[model samples]
Target: MESVITGLILLLVLLVFISEIYKIRFERKNESQDERGQFLIFKVKSLSYTILSAGIFIGFALVAILKVMKPEIFIYYMIIVYLFQSVASSIYLSIVRKI
Candidate 1:
């Protein structure tokens, strides 16, 4: 049951990311009219990609840590690790924007 729920959640996140990227790409068609907005969007999308890449890196780190430690609640620990990665990415982006 938990695995099924996790699968569904991941699917939903994938769909959301795809739809958002598609929507941004479609909006790029009228570039001349909205250069500023387009630039901002591009920066945001780039930052999002960075965030995703960082998350993947963190996930690999988590797997290594789990393999070494072999915790009893491995799945739960992985989920928590992923969540931390997401939060770290968000924080990093937010800080970058501020600077």
Candidate 2:
């Protein structure tokens, strides 16, 4: 039962993630006429990607060095990286858009 519940939760989360991706893609396709906004979005995305990539690489190295082979650990690390990237991007966009 626990495993079933967990699977359902994971499914819901995946659906939500997919929906968010879809929404973002749709929104980007109809970008605003404001070039500055678009530029800021591009910058935020680039910065977030860089941070996420570096974090994942470091995580992989640490896991390898520590001999940690648990899939759950890697999943948790990825979740943290993703959350951090999202928050960082939002903060950067907010600050830059204010300028």
Candidate 3:
């Protein structure tokens, strides 16, 4: 129950963030920097996918070999993966933009 509530809260926050990003992208505030912005978007996507793949693979291995039987563990693992993905993407974006 607690996990469900937490997930709902995180979902709401993520939705808000996505909407803000959408607005920023469409606002044309950086019309002259489309290439850089697109590069950042694609780079972050690629990195996030890589992290997600690795995370899922490790999670499956834990369940298959280590006998991780609790569903909550999987849920928490996914939440952690999402957080890591967000953090890593943010960091990568900031670094690339600085360059």
Candidate No. with top TM-score: 3
Ten residues in sequence with the least summed lDDT for candidate 2? 24-33
- Model 2 misplaced stretches (Cα beyond 4 Å): 1-32, 66-71
Which residue segments of model 3 deviate by more than 4 Å?
1-33, 68-71
What overall lDDT, based on C-alpha atoms, would model 3 receive against the true structure? Answer: 0.70
| Candidate 1 local distance difference test against the native | 0.55
Clash-forming residue pairs, model 3: none
lDDT of each: 0.55, 0.70, 0.70
Per-residue lDDT of candidate 3, residues 1-99 (tens digit): 999988976885675476446435533557325986767778867988999899888887787777765656887787677666766666666576678
Candidate 2 lDDT, 1-99, residue by residue in tens: 999967865765665466456436634664533776578778878988999999888788767776664656888778767766766666666577578
Better of 2 and 3 by lDDT: 3
Candidate with the larger TM-score of 1 and 3: 3
How close is every model to the real structure, measured as TM-score? 0.43, 0.62, 0.63
- The alpha-carbon lDDT assigned to residue 59 of candidate 1 equals 55
